[model samples]
Target chain A: MSFVSYLLNGISLGSVYAIIALGYTMVYGIAKMLNFAHGDVIMIGSYVAFVAINSMGLPIPVAILLSVAACTLLGVTIERVAYKPLRHASKLAVLITAIGASYFLQNVALLIFGANTKSFSSVVKMQPIQLAGGQLNITGETIVTVAACIVIMICLMAFMKYSKAGHAMLAVSEDGGAAQLMGINVNGTIALTFAIGSALAAIAGVLLCSAYPSLTPYTGAMPGIKAFVAAVFGGIGSIPGAFIGGILLGVIEILGKAYISSQLADAIVFAVLIIVLVVKPTGLLGKQIQEKV
Target chain B: MKKLSKTTKSSLITYGIVVFAYIFCEIFMRTGHMSSLLKGILVPLCVYVVLAVSLNLTVGILGELSLGHAGFMCVGAFASAVFSKCMMETITVPTLRFALALLVGVVCAGVCGVLIGIPVLRLRGDYLAIVTLAFGEIIKNLVNVIYLGVDSNGFHVSMKDAMSLQMEPDGLVIIKGAQGITGAPTDSNFTIGVVLVLITLVVVTNLVHSRTGRAIMAIRDNRIAAESIGINITKYKILAFSISAALAGAAGVLYAHNLSTLTALPKNFGYNMSIMILVFVVLGGIGSIRGSMIAAVVLTLLPELLRSLNEYRMLIYAVVLIATMIFTWSPSAIGFRERYSPAKLFHKREKGVQ
Candidate 1:
């Protein structure tokens, strides 16, 4: 592939990461907890889509809808069951519970699906567009993933800005106690945040699997972690930061693999994280807050 | 006077648990009445015990969450494995070689601990967690790329491939790229593992009771106050973290020597392994040494005991994990524990007798 195609690949991959990071940032913004299980929700969405399309013989669109709806429900249920009780608990406790929920989701997928990688047919079937005298080609999947990510970002921004529910989410995220006092049902907004995040996870899952073309119980794990790193890199809880962070991480990862040693790509990526963290803990675009006594 | 007696009482109980474990393993081994599966897990159970206890030093005592203990273990495993491989011809005695290798592993891992702790410990909370996690990943990845071999001509290092190892015809390959160390001596046994566990317990419990330990806990409980009280925060944090790393390295040596073929697969020393260790620490109740030990041994053996359940084993493990966290940390569970705790009953009995 030419340099252009490689950059395109990175853009496509980064867009998928951005979608996943949105879930993380949304949940973190609203709940003040890292939804570690959010990654596994991607896995769940992919599996649900797989079953709907391949096993149940449903159309691709219906399968996509099923995946999104299932993930939305799963996300809400997880928040209610595992996270709700621990809302007032220690951060460490909530973090561990999130880890537990992540573990639970992965293992349940393993139990149901077994520890095997499943081949997933491309959701978006279109001819690859040849460019630069056939030197550069972009697949339909890549186009769809990138386009859909942009659309989602726009929709999310508009929703957060204009929608009443979105405004409620913003209020809850700012201060749950204050929002509750303002008669904005804190739990409901939090639940809505999870639903929206998980629904995005479904889109990300399908797009990611389409690009990668393989699905395992752990397919979401590395991407999940990388997306989280992206979120952190962009400054956690900032939507645009997540967007830019995801793209930048993706480009760096792709370019590192293309130029540097493939084995060292993950290390290089993490090394960048260390450097960023050491230099600026709040990450790019993150606001600084004074430490309170 | 009561406090002194209470310290003795707790130490006595700690020793009692160790003795009980040793005897139980001994009886199982000598009797041979139990399944081979039980015997097989003894060494691993002990390794997990050491790992859990040492991790408790950072997570529980230091009040910093480190998700990179496995990375330290990985460092120790490879360092010790390389040492043993290099000394294979020179040192004929397996026992002596294993002991020397263990020392080497501890030093290497402890050095890694200090190196990682210095820069990473400056950050706190989630940032610290992710950075340490990154450090762990970096170490794991570096080990995979790093190739070390030993021959009569001495050690040859390479990064690209094994063919870069231009050594004498009989040069022993020690860390092949991704393939890891092979033909390693399996010197780990139930007895040695138990001894390591005891050593870990002694070190950790002593540290927890010492003045340094008090300062460390104080830092964990309230860093600002600890700093105000003139505790050298960085010194104590690094001291606790490196010690924890050193202990994890010791566990790594035990684990590396236990297996004939030690591969640096992500499964062995990756994020998953790190998370699992954290789970042991968290589920055992943060900062509770004995709790970590019990949780480690039980959780390790739980899957093995449930082997007959096959697919249900991990499912059950997940349920138990979530349930344990809920019960241990949930508000309702706190209420339950406060009412029915054995320690409370013991305190009541002592008061009555007085």
Candidate 2:
């Protein structure tokens, strides 16, 4: 593949990771709990899409909306059920709960849907776009998918940066107690954070399904880790940083496929993550804050 | 909690596990058909106890959530399989082969544990979780690619005629390509597994009760405070990790020998196993050794009990796990704190209480 092709692929794939990552980073930023189930939210989103498309027989647009809606609701359900009760528990317990939720989701998906891989049939695959050279050929699905991700991400970023709800989220994430004292409903902001992250995960599921049609119960597993890595790479709590990190990670992974042994490709991505963590745990855009003794 | 000598407590748990195993085997014989199913459940139960306890050392005791025990188990499984296969020709005794295989597996896993532990020791909090998760994927992926076949087909003896077998000294039998190692002696019995699990429980319990274990739990409670008091955080983390790895290695051997069919699949040792084992530790309550064993057995038996649910087994598990997580998490639930807590149990009450 050409460098441009690699870059395009990286940015597109990375955006999906960034979308999934935003959920992880924001939750971690606010709660200091690793939501292992966040990855499974993407899995759940794909299933919601499966239900909307297969069972409901809704229009593609309606199906996407339904998936996103279901994901948002489920996100809140998780917070309420798994997280809300554990707020006062040791942070490790919350983390363990998240893992339990993650395993629970994947297993449930397996039992309900069967372990066989499902493919989302597409009418968009036939239309292939020809680039300037014969060397590069992009499909219609890829184009729409990438473009949709960029637009959704921009909207999400805007919502976080300017909206009152977003500012409240920022305040609560910074200091939940202080934010509560300042008349901000910290719990409400957290629920909103989950909602936004979940909605993005649903979008990511749709895009991933389009790019790679097969959807397994565990499909979100790898991307979950990679996106979190991306989030960490850019700065765990930073939205734009997640975007940049995701794209950069995607590009590196793809380019490594060509320049390095593909067998070690995944390892290299994580190796870089470790190196980055060792050098700067707070990440590029994140400022270091000393934990209060 | 009353105080008992470490050696005595260890012996008690060990003997208790052995007696429990005999009774369990009696129940298995009483359950009638589907003996394989019973064995399957028993095997994983025994194995998972070790895995959960080993993982608890890191996630529970060491104050780091490392999701890589499955990776170490993978190392153990492969190492055990290789060791047994290599010894197949030289060691004709089936039982001895099994014993040696497990021994080799545990050692290999322990070495790998230490190797991986070095860099990860520096990490703490969720950063440790992410790094361990990454390391797990790396190990699994690497194993998926690396394989060495058994040189059983008479060593090809100068690559004789293309269509012919190279005989002369020995018979032709070849280890297949990434086809999975098969036909190992059925060396893993329920008794062996229970013994190992019991041994692991005792060893781990003793370690946890030891000064080292207390130091680990203290670190888990408050890293800075523990460090301030002169606890070598990284050293204890590594020690706990290596022990965890060794236990997981022993479990891997059990899994490999009992299952017979072995393949290098990353997916097998993937995040799900890690998470499942962690749930066992969490559900049982971290820092509680007996709790770890109980949770492991319960979670292990749960899927079996739900077998009647057929396809709904996992859905039921999800419900059960979620419900239990909620139940344990609720502040009103008294023992819930005891079950899921990773903190040190000791408390220095106020002067007025005395």
Candidate 3:
């Protein structure tokens, strides 16, 4: 029964990672750049949601909508101000700029919120579900997080499959020059991708805070890096891959903590990533790109 | 020959800068004009310079982005500290002991670099960067759990705890898990650090201009072309990476010896530290050795110089970082620079005279 409970908890945690990893994969797929600032955007979104719900006394859904809108605008603004001008710059230059933007966001949060950690009140008000005569328990946050992850994943897949904007995104990701030649708005598609990714990040931030019940400026950084690891684990630029990788990574992390020394759990997770990459260089589902002379 | 080659002139200028800085510092200290705070950072400044120059060999010269430089530094620091701690009694001569400790640090880190690079360098671009990041995290995590001790019955190692080590009653714990190693000999000073910096500059700059350096750069420019030309890609990559790792290890030795307690904290030896070093490399202009050295010194001193601003320090740093990146890399900024560059102006004046 305890083992069953641990697995459930792992899946719940994994769902949060999946949500974050989806943002990373989408951005990387279209832009071909690792928006290192994406994690800090999660921090900003959570703070916005925190302010809206606690200070303004708004409804949870309304707070979430406000947070999403703020993050979407921020995402587009960052892309235009910091990233768009560097479209033809070296990859490292773009990466460093993204890092600078991340530092800027974190510093801003520090100044505004101070260095103290906020105790996030759980937005999920429902009671935990007891199964097998209360031997196993699942919290409402867990159920909501997992269900939200699944719905988002499905919606995203359907969007890419059917929507006109989604088709433009697919075309842009496939080949930016060719897509532009075919009358697709390359820059607009990329901006839409960032907007969508940042909006998902806001939701992920809320769910993450509700589950953890703590909010700090640095909260998103470690998880962000782990989600990036998950993104690469499943196969970067692949949507379904991020989901599977996130779940597997989350499960492995929790199980490692339970069965092995908790201190070694992080090492074990990274080691597994290394082994996976060594055996499958491109990743579990990453397409092998051939070099053209 | 009446004139020096371009590379030689540049190398001479780099060496001249370091010598001039050393002489200036010496004069300031002698005249009682140096602050305690500024004096304290002299050794660390050298450490950063060595780290920046070495990482440039990989990221700049070899054109591979490595996020594990700090991991190698952690390995070197811990290895050298442990060596110094165990031999504190037996090695009566501090200089010889410190030299041997430096050797141990360099070897351990270099070996780990080779071991990691063999598997990691096979991947390219983002995959390679992520793998290095993973390896770095693994190193930090593993070091946090390690427990080591020395006693009359030799050394005892355990992952569980001090009790599990099962050392004799008189055993001395050198490494106390997360507490890390303590009481290592403080045998480093500003002079030794500067000397090491000079050595590193010589080795790295010489390597960058050598045949092997050219081969590495060729691989960086075009791997397929280099491979077609019969250059051994794997060998040069590993060689350059390991050498860079070894120099970072040397910096770690200087860093460890200058401090009383050596702990593997994330701020000192984690992803952030690696990125900080990379920032030095990138901001200095990738592949520009002289620029990396100057950038490391200036950036390290910037925060200290801005101590009056306190709260706004990091914010200003972030803004400056973004502004510098834009100035250096943005298309319009580059065009603006070239249009009014000093060299271009000098050439125009010469053309007018002609």
Candidate 4:
């Protein structure tokens, strides 16, 4: 493939990462905890969509809707059942609980799904767009994924900036105690944050499954981790930073696969993160945090 | 003279584990009713014990969360495997070679620890966790691409295909990229694994009680205060981390030697394995050595014990993990622990004095 095609592939992949990273950054920003189960949420979303389309014989659009709704509910339920009780617990405890929830979700999927990889039908059906007199080609799936990501990013930014619920989320993220004192329901705002994040994970999961064409109980794990790295790379709590980091990481990963060793692409991606973090602990766009004595 | 003392608590627990493990193995061996499946898990159980205890040093004692422990294990496994493969012809005796391989594995893992510690020890909290996670992934992937061969001319290492090794026609391939080291002597057994576990427990417990161990704990409890008190934070951090890595490597050697065919996979030495060890550390209660040992053995054996559950085994394990975390850390549970602490038995004597 030509360099442009490789770059295009990277862009498409990066958009997916950006979408997933948004969920991670948003939840981390508000809840002050890494939702380790976020990836498994994506897995659950894909399974839901798969079941809606193939098993229930639903249309593509309705399948997407059902998947998103299921994910939102799952996200809210997890936060209530697993996370809420540990609200005042140690950081280590909260983190372990998140890991446990992650394993719980994955294992539940494994038991139900039997550790098999299911083929997913693409929701977007269109011919490949040929470029440079058929020397290069790009799938319609790529175009839709990239465009959808851009649209979602813009909508998210606008919602955070203008909407009342968005304002409440921001307030809670800034200071939960202060937000509670100001008549905002802190738990409700946090729950809404999870809902939105889970919905976004669903979108990312669908696009990822469509592009990859195979769905398994663990399909969401690697992408979830990479997106998290992107969020951290751009700045863990910054939405715009997550967007930028996700794209950059995708581009670098694809380019490395093309030019360098394809097998070592993951190592390169992580090495870059280690270097960037060593140089800037808060990430590129993250604000400086001062630890109080 | 028959009465228990405060210091004896740790030794009692330590000796208890060793003695109990010995008796358990003896009973299982002597009895014909025990399943072969349960017998096979003994070595793995001991390996997990060492892993959990070593990981506790970094997570519990040093107060830093490292998610790349499996990387150290991977390093040790490959290092020992390669060393044994190279010395196959030179060392005719299996026992001597296994002992030498263990040393090589421990030292190599320790070196890797120091190397990773230098860059990683600077970061704190979640960032440290992520970096170590990245390191673990990198090591696993790197192992996938590595090609090592042995021949009359000595060792040959390459990243490409076996042909790239450029060895003589009869050269033996040690690590064939993804196919890992093959034909390495399977010298590990329950007895050796138990010895390693005992060594790990003794070393970690001693370090926890020693002055250096206290300094490490101080760093964990409060880094700023530890530094204020003129503690060499870097020295202690590296020391604890390296020691942890070395022990993990020892466990890896045991693991590598036990299996006939060893390959580096995500399920084996990847993120999943790292998280599994961390589960043991966290569930056991941080800073509690005996707690880690008990947690490791129980968690390792839980699935085996629930063999009848079949497919539902992992699901049950997950629930147990979630439940354990919630119970151990929740505030209400704190009340239960305070009231029912093991020291409560001595409360009657204290009440008489009062």
Best by TM-score: 3
Q: In order of the candidates, what TM-score does chain B achieve?
A: 0.92, 0.81, 0.96, 0.93
Q: Which 10 consecutive positions of candidate 3 chain A have the poorest summed lDDT?
A: A117-126
**Which ten residues in a row are the worst by lDDT in model 1 chain B?**
B1-10
CA RMSD of all predictions: 2.8, 5.6, 1.5, 2.7
Better of 2 and 4 by lDDT: 4
The model with the greatest DockQ is 3
- Candidate 2 global lDDT: 0.78
Best by lDDT: 3
TM-score of each candidate structure, all chains considered together = 0.95, 0.87, 0.98, 0.95
Tens-digit lDDT track of model 1 for B1-354:
455667657876987898897997798778887788787888888889999999999999999988888999999998998888777788999889989999999999999999989999998877788888898899999999988877898889998898889989998778888888898888889889988999899999998999999999999989899899899999999999999999999999999999988887788899889888988888888888899999898889899989999888877887787777678667887898998899998999999999
Locate the minimum summed-lDDT window of 10 residues in model 2 chain B.
B154-163
Least well predicted 10-residue stretch by lDDT in candidate 4 chain B: B6-15
Worst 10 residues of 2 chain A by lDDT: A120-129
For model 3, name the residue pairs that clash.
none
Off by over 4 Å in 2: A1-3, A50-57, A107-116, A123-128, A258-264, B1-14, B24-34, B150-178, B332-354
Model 4 agreement with the true structure over B124-187: per-residue lDDT tens digits: 8878989999999999999999998877898899998899999998888889899888888888
Candidate 2 per-residue C-alpha lDDT over B1-354 given as tens digits, one digit per residue, 9 for 90 to 100: 889977677668756865776686767677874466775677777788878878777766776777777888988888888777767789998778988998899999999989888887776666677778777877776665553443445244222222244344434333332345677666787778777877887788778778988998898788889999999988887888898888888888888888777765655687667777888888888766677778888877887888887877766776777677667666866475675555523332344366
All candidates: DockQ: 0.72, 0.51, 0.82, 0.72
lDDT of 3 by residue, A116-208 (tens): 999888778889999999998999999999999999999999999999999999999999999999999999999999999999999999999
